[model samples]
Target: AQSVTQLDSHVSVSEGTPVLLRCNYSSSYSPSLFWYVQHPNKGLQLLLKYTSAATLVKGINGFEAEFKKSETSFHLTKPSAHMSDAAEYFCVVSGSAGQFYFGTGTSLTVIP
Candidate 1:
């Protein structure tokens, strides 16, 4: 079984500052992890993914995440925050059985 937990339900960041969204997962085997962002009334977009190929994965909008097997964590980060970055983020984990587990979600607010 695989499960994902998003430690924060909301995150606030100032424009031009950095952003961080914490996530943790549990699985019997090596799991596939991903981050997706959903803008208001828009579809979800893949932010980054970890599929055993690379420990550090980068995605759109200067976002990135590091897979830490020891800690069972895949936390997302951005160098600078933008107002347009305000959105809902989800942390997902897939187990070997092909079942997907999603975190409740984290609403990010970028303040001017």
Candidate 2:
């Protein structure tokens, strides 16, 4: 079975500081990993995807993650936080049905 586990249900950050959110995944086969960001009342946008080709991947909005096979983890990081970055993030693992299973959701709060 392919599954994704996010270490945090919520993450709070201050404006201009670094942001880190943790995620771990498990899959029977080689996996496809994705990070998606959802703003308020908006649809999800693909942040990045690791398609078994890259160990380290970069995404939109200055976000990035490294796919660690040993640790079974893909953690998202950003150098600086912006108010616009305050949104819900989801860790996803691609499944057999051409679908992606999402984390419960991570709410990012940006303190001014």
Candidate 3:
């Protein structure tokens, strides 16, 4: 079985501040991890993905995540927060069976 967990349901940050969205996962075997973001009234878009390639994966909008197998974590981070970055982020994990598990989601609030 595979599962995805987003530690924070909501996160607030001021403009120019660093952003961190924690995510942990569990799987019976090596799992593929992905981060998706949904802006207001917009469709979900892939932020990044980890598919057993480089441990450190970079995504759009200056976002990146490191796959730590020992810790079973793939936390997302950004050097700075922008007003446009405010949105709902989802952490997803997929198993070899082609089944995908999604986290509840984390709402990011960017304050000026």
Candidate 4:
């Protein structure tokens, strides 16, 4: 069975500070990983993705994630946080069988 786990339910950061959201996963084979962000009552948007092409994947809004195969982790990071960065982030994993697994989600709060 494949599953995704977001280590933190909520992460609060001051504006201009660095942001980090932890995530881990379990899969039988190499999986496709993605990070998505959703605002209040808004649709989900793709932040980044790891498709076995690169270990370090960069996305919009200065977001990036490193895929650690040995550790089964794909942790999201941002150099600086902005007030608009506040949103719900989800770590998703898709296996070879075409099954998608979504994490519980991590809410990011930007403190001004």
Candidate 5:
């Protein structure tokens, strides 16, 4: 079984402050994790992925996350938040084949 739960459905942060998004997952096999950002009226883009690779993965737009198997979590973090970072993020869990499952989705609001 493979599943993921985002601790928050929405996160609000100031334009210059750091951003944190929590996610937890359960998988029977070694999981393939991904974080995708979706802007309004736009498609989803791959932020990063963990395919039994490095534990700490750096992504685009100053975003990064660490895969903790013991904690069963993969939390996203950013040094500073930007207005462009305001978007919907989905925590994806994919196994063999092209199967993809998305999280409930997190809406990030960047305040000025």
Candidate 6:
């Protein structure tokens, strides 16, 4: 069984400040992880992905995430926040069999 947890259900950050969205996951085997962002009335967009190639992965829009096996975490971060960054983020865990488990979802609010 696989489970994903987004530490904060909602997070607020000021523009130009650092942003951190923590996520923890558990799985029986090595699983693939992904972060997705969804804007208002829009579909989900791939934020970043980890497939065991690298411990740190960078994604579009200045977003990145690091895979930490020891900590069982895949937390997302950005050097600075932008107003456009306000959106809902989702943490996903995928098994080898193509089964996907989604976290509760984190809503990000960027203050200008």
Candidate 1 accuracy as lDDT:
0.94
Model 1 / residue 38 / CA error / Å: 0.4
| Per-residue C-alpha lDDT of model 2 across residues 1-112, encoded as one tens digit per residue | 8888999999999999999999999888778899999999999999999977789899999999999999999999999999999999999999887888787778899999
Among residues 3 or more apart in sequence or in different chains, the pairs in candidate 2 whose N, CA or C atoms overlap within 3 Å are none
**Candidate 4 residue lDDT tens string, 53-97:** 789999999999999999999999999999999999999999787
Rate residue 104 of model 3 by lDDT: 96
lDDT of 5: 0.92
Name model 2 segments beyond 4 Å from true.
none
Per-model CA lDDT versus the true structure: 0.94, 0.92, 0.95, 0.96, 0.92, 0.96
- lDDT tens digits, residues 1-112, model 6? 8999999999999999999999999999998999999999999999989977899999999999999999999999999999999999999999768989999999999999
Residue-level lDDT of model 5, residues 46-67, one tens digit each, is 9988867689999999899899
lDDT of 3 at 99: 80
Native-referenced Cα lDDT, model 2? 0.92
Candidate 1 C-alpha lDDT tens digits along 19-53: 99999999998888999999999998999889788
Question: Which ranges in model 3 have alpha carbons more than 4 Å from their true place?
Answer: none
lDDT of 3 by residue, 10-112 (tens): 9999999999999999998888999999998999999999978699999999999999999999999999999999999999999787888999999999999
Worst 10 residues of 2 by lDDT: 96-105
Which predicted model would earn the best lDDT? 4
Weakest lDDT window of 10 consecutive positions for candidate 3: 91-100
TM-score of each: 0.96, 0.95, 0.97, 0.97, 0.95, 0.97
Clashes of each: 0, 0, 0, 0, 0, 0
The deviation in Å at residue 28 for candidate 1 is 0.5
